[model samples]
Target: MLQVRLLGCFALEQSQRDQSAVLGRNGRRLAAYLFAYPNRSHRRDKLIDLFWTESAPDQGRTAFSTALWKIKRTIGASGRQMALHAVGQNVVLEIAKPAIVDAHRFASDIEVALSASCADSIRPAIELYSGAFLEEFDGDWVLEERERLEVLYVRALTLMMRQAANQSRYEDALCCARRILATDPMRESAQRATMLLYTLNGQRGQAIRQFERCRATLREECGVDPMPETRSLDLMIRSGAVFERIPTLLNETFGTGG
Candidate 1:
């Protein structure tokens, strides 16, 4: 039996026993959307509207039907069984039991990692996050899911960095912080974390340089100064008090580190 799972930012296929194939972009998209909204039946008109919004109405309908037929042909008998019922205007795909999807699994694992008491338990979960949800699909239907996944991605990385810091793994924390900042240069939490990691590891000069680069980027791009909290962090570094009161400084900065 083929197990198809979908949750949040992860999607996985188990039991490669079935060699089902979905050919072409539009055909693949139809299958993917149907799989994603398994509980809901979609109207033929609605599917046409979504995928061929820019095409002429008659042409769009023709295209939609062609794609649907392709999906049916690709999955063969399993495809026909998966098709619950298609009345004159609506078609529904049905599963006998709950489907397993990688997106859903990834979300579940991320939630557990977020709530875990130990960082070690969360490490493997973080590693499971391969990439954004449905990286291949760029339709309007997928945008919201992508954004939601991105936020979770950032939060997971942040949690890992904090865990490393708690264990005095400054180098590891620095690497995590840098990765976050690369994705979001304006992420103050990551910037502050990097600064703190540098300071803790006796790389005060590098820490100060990080601040300088951030200041330049913010000024050139946003025409704004760094937040007072980040400025204060730089001050702490200059005064040689960063290591002595690292936690206190982090608490004060809150959201202005990167």
Candidate 2:
């Protein structure tokens, strides 16, 4: 099966073997743009305007043709296999299907996981996500997709952390929560989860430190304070509330008390 993975960057293939040749920066940008807008056909002129915005109209068209040729050469397309089709003064490139792109796969997995009732069934699918859809690409066209995928990634990570906590894998839960917090420090659920994990591990000072750091980050970067829930948790930890309740709560909740 052919896959055109776009995880870290653009890659093309026939079957599992990659047929993608090393493209220069411009060619890579073109490929990234097309992969990002696979469903919609883009006009050659629009692409020229987007990438070669500094060039004159005629020069832009020339540059666009050069980019298209480079892509074709790199992907081993012959003749009209990857040619610009005229469409009312606008030329569009036709992208073929059954293509395995990372963003597509990530979206598919997210949909499946959302539909599935059993969290266990979605674990493997969630694990398939290594990073953001196209972590390196930061073009204006891709920002919306990037934000969407980031939300999905955080939710998947939260689910995984919850599952780990349920399984008494406090260490694993802590690690996953830390990762989520690193990406979005304002994610109160992840922060709460990390605090819970620290309390479970008897790292009271560390738990307090986590809360303090979260508070500092939010204030410094976002000009906001931590949520009431987080502040309450901080107060609880400082007043020995968490430690005092740990034995009974752990026994009743997880059925394992240390």
Candidate 3:
């Protein structure tokens, strides 16, 4: 079985060995495109338009043909049944046996986790998101799907964080919160969550410092102050007030809930 990894980096592995070198860079991109839309027939002309636009029409056609042929040859040499097929005017990726596409599996696992009540069910999906979708590749075609998967990744992390906090696992919850902030420093809700978690973990100084960082980030990026709720939280913490779980506050604020 061919394992296609479209998350983080682009790789095609078979029998636990890397086969990406067989396709080279451009060949890998072409193959990755087909796997990104697996089992779907993509018109050859459309592919030429997408990948060979920089060349003259004749040159583009020749390049497209060469790329497609290379893809076919590489897959054929894998010692497995054909994974690429030419049907009528379109090309299709139809692995004879099951293939593991990380993007597909991530979506499927996350979908199942979303519908389940058990928080632990989300772990598998979270672990599958190794990094941004196709982190090494970029184009107009990749943006929407990349953003979509990133949103799912952040959502999964947030769910895990809240569940851990609810269970009084401050350290674990803080880890998730920090990851969220790392992915998106502009996320004030995650910043707030981090602050709260730090205080809960008996690190009041770090909590105050987190607030200062949030205030600085918002001011620098948006030229604005922290939201009122965040400001209030900062004040309470600075005044040495007793802390409590303010998940409700996070939910009602101008950003995603903690």
Model 1 lDDT tens row, 69-180:
7765544455433554567899776755432445545566777767764456656766655666566677777778667766766777787777677667778888778877
> What are the per-residue Cα lDDT tens digits for candidate 3 across 168-237?
7889999898888877888888887888778778999999999999999989999999888788888877
Over 4 Å off, model 2: 1-3, 11-22, 77-99, 243-258
TM-score of each: 0.75, 0.79, 0.87
- Tens digit of lDDT per residue, candidate 2, span 1-258? 435666655566665555555555666777777766664667676777788888889888877777776665655543333433546545455555413566777767776786664556656766666666567767767678777877877777767676777777889878778878877888876786687789877788898899988898889989999998778778988898877776554444334553
Question: Candidate 2 lDDT (Cα, whole model)?
Answer: 0.69
For candidate 3, what is the TM-score?
0.87
Whole-model lDDT values for every prediction: 0.69, 0.69, 0.78
Model 1 lDDT vs. the true structure? 0.69
State the displacement of the C-alpha of residue 70, model 1, in Å, after optimal TM-score superposition.
2.4
Best by lDDT: 3
When sorted by TM-score, best at the front, the candidate numbers are 3, 2, 1
Report how far off residue 57 is in candidate 2 (Å). Answer: 0.9
Give Cα distance to truth, residue 249, candidate 1, Å.
Answer: 2.3
Error of 3 at 81 (Å): 7.2
